[model samples]
Target: MTLIHPAEDLGVLRFITAGSVDDGKSTLIGRLLYDSKAVLSDQLSALARAKHKRTAGEDIDLALLTDGLEAEREQGITIDVAYRYFATAKRKFIIADTPGHEQYTRNMVTGASTAHAAIILIDATRVSEVDGRTELLAQTKRHSAIVKLLALPHVIVAINKMDLVDYSEARFDAIRAAYLALAQRLGLQSVRFVPVSALKGDNIVTASERMPWYQDEPLLDVLESLPVGEVSGSAAELRFPVQLVARQDGSHADDFRGYMGRVEAGAISVGQALRVLPAGHRATVAEIIGPRGELAHAHAGQCVTVRLAEDVDISRGDILVAAEATVEPARKLSADLCWFDHEPLSSQRKYILKQTTANVFARVGSVDSVLDVGTLSHGQHKGTLEMNDIGAVQISLQKALVCDTYEQHPATGAFVLIDEATHHTVAAGMIRAFTA
Candidate 1:
């Protein structure tokens, strides 16, 4: 056996497990934790007490481990994104178990935005009436579309409930073929198919004896072997948003005056030059300090106080980027909107547009079209977007925002629209290239 070198090991693989309600998403996660011994004895005792059993025996209702919410337990469905952390000998994992219902698509988006991979479960036993057809669910397709849009590097299509289908290889093959076609059409780069029985523990933690015809790595094995994705810095240009002005405003004000924020992308070195966005001021990095102490360099995700060579009037929402790779500032942006509110959007009405750390007043200029997840087709212009609608929209911002296209840089490319009075987030949007 070849030993995996320490340098090659990816510390953790963040992934999301999503599918329609009652598709056994919670059970699968519980099974993974229980079968892999990730669950504690106390958790097992609690599961026993909950009495959410599929059968009458000592079989613990695995879903109870993730369905922690009282409402979820009562209704027998996941209403929000439930995150769980577990690890195996090979690699660590952060699992986001997102809700499957179409109404909660926004929750799924929130969970998957930072994920490196997506495990979309398909209910193999779910059959249609009339003639007994088992096509993929529309929700599954919708999740896939979102995952594709998020640009998750890895995709795993787990055909679940194989036991209910008598562990038929033909059924799994058919579903695999159909899903593969969908993946190709959606331009999903890397995709793999697996047959599993989340309830019976087939192809999850261990290889099942029932599916003898299949010979491949189990679901956990695939997850274990997948390479961790690169840091955001590698995916996009440098973008450092100033969250605060780190100043004592007292005796140490002169010594402690620095810009405090996260390195959203790329690295920062002591002597590197940076251009402050919106302010259009140039400065050189004089120092970088972290939580521990001083740092010569800082990379993406590291929150550090950056000292500049010159005192530039930088405020919250101002970005520090490489002078060579500066992005364009625009007030009008064409973007794809994921409307989460029950109230349909009105083009003439004013709303709050929050892009990055900046919040400005805005209004919808146009609703070009709505996308049909079922057919992967775009429909004619809809005047308003109802709840859980995905469409193309034009937004006019009160102030210009330095931004990039979602295809170019996700950090600056995505934003949310909020109601003026309620302050509730009504829509999430991604830049679709056109900006002015």
Candidate 2:
């Protein structure tokens, strides 16, 4: 009964759960936390005494654990992204229980942006068999398409509520086959399927005894075994965005200047040559400073202060990269966007496009195409992108931005568009490629 401490040298796996409304996403998460011994006794007591229990006969409604808002509890729906952390002997997990309703698609995008994997739930009872063909829900298709767009490393399709279906292997197989076709059309890889009853706590943390016909590992085991981080591509390339410039002037000889930020993509070591962009100033790493002390090197995810061998005109919006790396600065780019605002996107309106530490004034040059989530096809844009719409569009920036394709490096490729007038974030975007 040993659990790994979150800070005890275990790799952290960030994942999100998505499905149609009432597909048992919250229940599945609660079961994982409760059965894995991660929930505290006091929390369990609170759950037992919860007045909004959805289950009958005094049975605890596990879904209540994540539906935190009173309105959500009363409505039996998740409104915002609910994050939960738990650690097993093998790895630490950060699970984001995202809302399943179509309107909350933006919240799902937020949860999936940084996730290493995505668990898409399928309600066994929701799958309708018509004319010997199964039809998946629209939300399910939308979420899966998003997971594909984000390029998540792994996708686990959990066919939940098996108890409601008599733990039927046929139901699981049918749903799996149906999802597989969708996955193929979306070009999704690294997908795994599991059958579980989130309410009955079957095949979540452990193998289900009733589903003896199923031979695959349980949901928890599959999650623990999956490889984390960038499994391939330019993940090894160094891409650090300078967040701040630390300066101290005691004397000319004692002048201290350090560029501070998190190493977003690869690794950096002392003596490594770096190119500052879009200024493109070249310098050698003089030192790497952490809060504790100076370090010889820093890797991705570590926040540190870097002193270059020579003083360069580096600023907050500047990016530092391996000098030999192939990167370009562009003033125009194409991107995939998930619009989140009630006001539809206007090509003429200006936005503050923020990527990492860089912020630049930009406008949607054109609305290339909008996705039809149900049919999984793209159609010509109708001049405006409405709330919860996903589309490919071109943006013109006032300043050149140094970036990579989202498929190449997610940390550097992701950005958010803020309404210039309201200052509220209007959309989340991933750069497809630089057009100019």
Candidate number with greatest lDDT:
2
Q: Alpha carbon lDDT of residue 147, candidate 1?
A: 89
Of the candidates shown, which would achieve the greatest TM-score relative to the real structure?
2
Please, what are the lDDT tens digits per residue for candidate 1 over residues 1-436?
2344676566789999988888899999999998888888898887887855554577789988888888888888888899998877677889999999988998998899889899999999773433454467889889998888777899998989999999999988888877887888889878988899998899999998999988998999999999875465632378888889977755765666799998877888888888898768888999999999999988877899999989889998998888776476788989888888888898877899887787789989888998788788877567889887888888888888888888777877888999998888998888887565
Going through the candidates in the order shown, the clash numbers are: 0, 0
RMSD of each: 2.7, 2.1
Local distance difference test, per candidate? 0.85, 0.90
* Residue 405 shift from truth in candidate 2, angstroms: 0.3
Model 2 score (lDDT): 0.90
Clashing residue pairs in candidate 2 (N, C-alpha, C atoms within 3 angstroms): none
Question: What is the Cα-based TM-score of model 2?
Answer: 0.96
lDDT agreement of model 1 with the native: 0.85
